[model samples]
Target: MTPHPAPQSRGVALFDLDGTLVDTTYLHTLAWWQALRRHGHTVPMVRIHRAIGMGSDRLLDAVLGPDRETGEDEALSDAHGTLYATWYDSLQPFEGAAALLRATAARGWRVVLASSASEEEVAAVRARLDADDVIDAATSSADADATKPAPDLVRAALDTVGAEPEEAVFVGDAVWDVEAAARAGVPCVGLLTGGTTRRELEDAGAVLVHDDPLDLLRHIDAGPLARPPAPGGTS
Candidate 1:
């Protein structure tokens, strides 16, 4: 048997689940709107959509304003959780999602998932991929001190995979993900699966933009994700 080269031994590919790996950003937007409506907060879907990448706490604050008392946060987040639960299977991983992860693993790269999603929600999402064979480690907001655009979440993911900040690349669909990756000093790759525009992602610090996880998967073997092909396949 051929030896498996460990691409991830030194650097890992960190992923943001929602817009980055799955097509659940808009679903999350609707869920948040319903959750807020249940609380009489009535946030607009557009704003909710814009805030989808943020963890519930940050999203609530973004839509509800910083003036909201910290005490109300837990209840609101719970409501959103219930609302989001209705769509557990509504979300499907983007094209090439599993392949991206598995291929990364095949290349000996450690694959880690980092998201603002709660533990249960993230578990459901990961279960859909069934990439237990590929994913090396994972982190969710439930385990992080802060969410995206802050680098805390990304750092948590790297730490989970026992990776260093400089040796990883983060992929996400939101401007905040780009910002967070930049802050963490990791290169950012943008996925258009989220609602954020290419310009916005670039402005936030994404250097490359792809259609989705699949696109990244197809191109990854060529870039920082690993060394070049093993050979004999270019023919």
Candidate 2:
């Protein structure tokens, strides 16, 4: 069960970007792999995908481990930014993702995007989602002191929307996202739209798991996301 209030409830909806919205986890993994290989580290895609939700700095360290010493977190980030920027024009929103956000926004929930992507990448995705008017605000790793699996990013997003923990819900695909949202005191709605398995997402802290965005949209009302009808009418 989602601990946070429903969509019509007085709260903000904080969302994770990469896999949750844009379906680009594998792309991110490949991009990081290319970046690492350019610097002489040959990491497998399978390992890199699991770490896709983490920011580039953390992903590099996670992939490269603590053994290799390099001060190029900035350089690698720059390379990724340059490479990933090219995909913005081609990025596609996941099924029902835009509608879900819009519906929640219409229902009185303030929508905010919380991502672990770089500033450049987050901007690209925002452009792709093009939900600027509907989205109350957005938070990226650039806006946070730490990355996902840490509560800072979620806290920043909540602050941006000016919503308290009890007044919000976080939706995401990764286990780290679950942990982060948990630390921030928000319920996590897990969607298996990304590459991760349902069992993994459920075990991570997802009270309700759905097949994808469309599945979630269909069940929003009865699934604990439907708040009491709004003031004038039902949301």
Candidate 3:
């Protein structure tokens, strides 16, 4: 009988874009706020800020509620997209964000970006991040049927890298990210750069929490990403 091939063990590191690596959380909040207002809705910025990690559809449902008129949803989303795109050229990656991706890749992790942003937006963020050399893959909203708090995006990232749930770790800056990772059976490390509280992240199932990419890079060896790979796996 022929012997079966052993399991491939290189772990996967999934990173969330937007507020996690880029300084666009508030920008997103502002855009969504303006979009809603333009559509004659008046949701609070604070609420919009908290819903930044979700996809536009989910964000609309979240801030506007299920009872909201569905006819204007497309217009609201388009308005927000146009507003947010105005800042594309000005987007900046967080401190150490590129280094973090490089460091994770150097440690044998296949780094993948898991985001709910549109393809164009992801491209803008990636250009600002300047870490494409080390990124094994990246997934945008078009790659998933659902967004954060639903696990589809997270799972899509895993599939892109051919990684099993146990062989991957996700990093993000929101409770929605943590919750999504949890539902996908992947542990998540939370960052506070998105303005989420430590307690809120913890409550949502983050394995560890840090202030930002710089902070997490400083302690990378102590977090879930530092854990040894499974037996028969390399790295």
Candidate 4:
């Protein structure tokens, strides 16, 4: 009988959709701010911006305090969603976001978008990304029991691609992303496009930081998404 070759090992590239790829950080911040105001809460935009990457519930907890009346949580989230939806048609992906996904796919990595956005929101943003050809899979808020800073979403994304933590790399633009990836046992690459400082992302456990998707693409070989060495070959 002829010998059979082993199956190829492929690494997974997990990416965050909002802010990391699409330029919706400020839009989210504004939406949340307006929602909070409508709910009689007056949180600062700076604080809301920093909390943009968190799930709606966590974001409310972080901004409105855990002691806040639970009765208004759902309403507040709905308000934000309504306000945010207004800009759906105008959403734009950061420069080189599609190229980065393509390049990573070309390098034999399975690219998966790990986003906390709802399915409808993910669809809208994916349309803006226009990189579905290279994306192997994508996870929405429904895929996980929890969200960023909790690791459930990251783990869900990993599961979607049948990837183990050690065989995956996550890329995002927030400290929450780094924290989530850390809890999921995957190294993360942070981007500055979402208004997060590099120091904050580094402190949260990002292995590397870049200015944005374009910057990361420019130095892809030097980051976590670099092609893995072949069997019995040097890196």
* Residue-level lDDT tens digits of model 4 in 1-235: 0011212645778899999999999999999999999988899999998888999989988888889898998899889889999999999999999999999988877788999998888989998899888787888888888877999999988787666888888999999999999999988999999999989988888999999999999999887688843433323
**lDDT by residue for model 3 over 109-223, one digit each (tens)?**
7888999898889999999999888887889988888888899999898888677887888999999999999999988999999999999999998989999999999998987
Q: What is the lDDT of candidate 1?
A: 0.77
CA lDDT of 95 in candidate 2?
87
**Which one wins by TM-score: 2 or 4?**
4
Backbone clashes in model 2, listed as residue pairs: 7-225
CA lDDT scores, all candidates in order? 0.77, 0.78, 0.87, 0.87
Name the runs in model 4 displaced over 4 angstroms: 1-9, 228-235
Q: Least accurate stretch of 10 residues (summed lDDT) in model 4?
A: 1-10
Candidate 3 residue spans exceeding 4 A from truth: 1-9, 231-235
Which 10-residue window of candidate 3 scores lowest in summed lDDT?
1-10
Tens digit of per-residue lDDT, candidate 1, span 74-177 = 88888878887887876788889988887777766667887778888888888777776667778877667788678888877777755677667788899889
Q: Which residue runs does candidate 2 get wrong by more than 4 Å?
A: 1-9, 228-235
- Candidate 2 residue lDDT tens string, 119-223: 667878878877776777777776887887889889888887556777778899988888899999888998886788889988888878888788888889876
Score every model by TM-score. 0.89, 0.90, 0.93, 0.93
Query: Which of 1 and 3 is ahead in lDDT?
Result: 3
Per-residue lDDT of 69 in model 1: 79
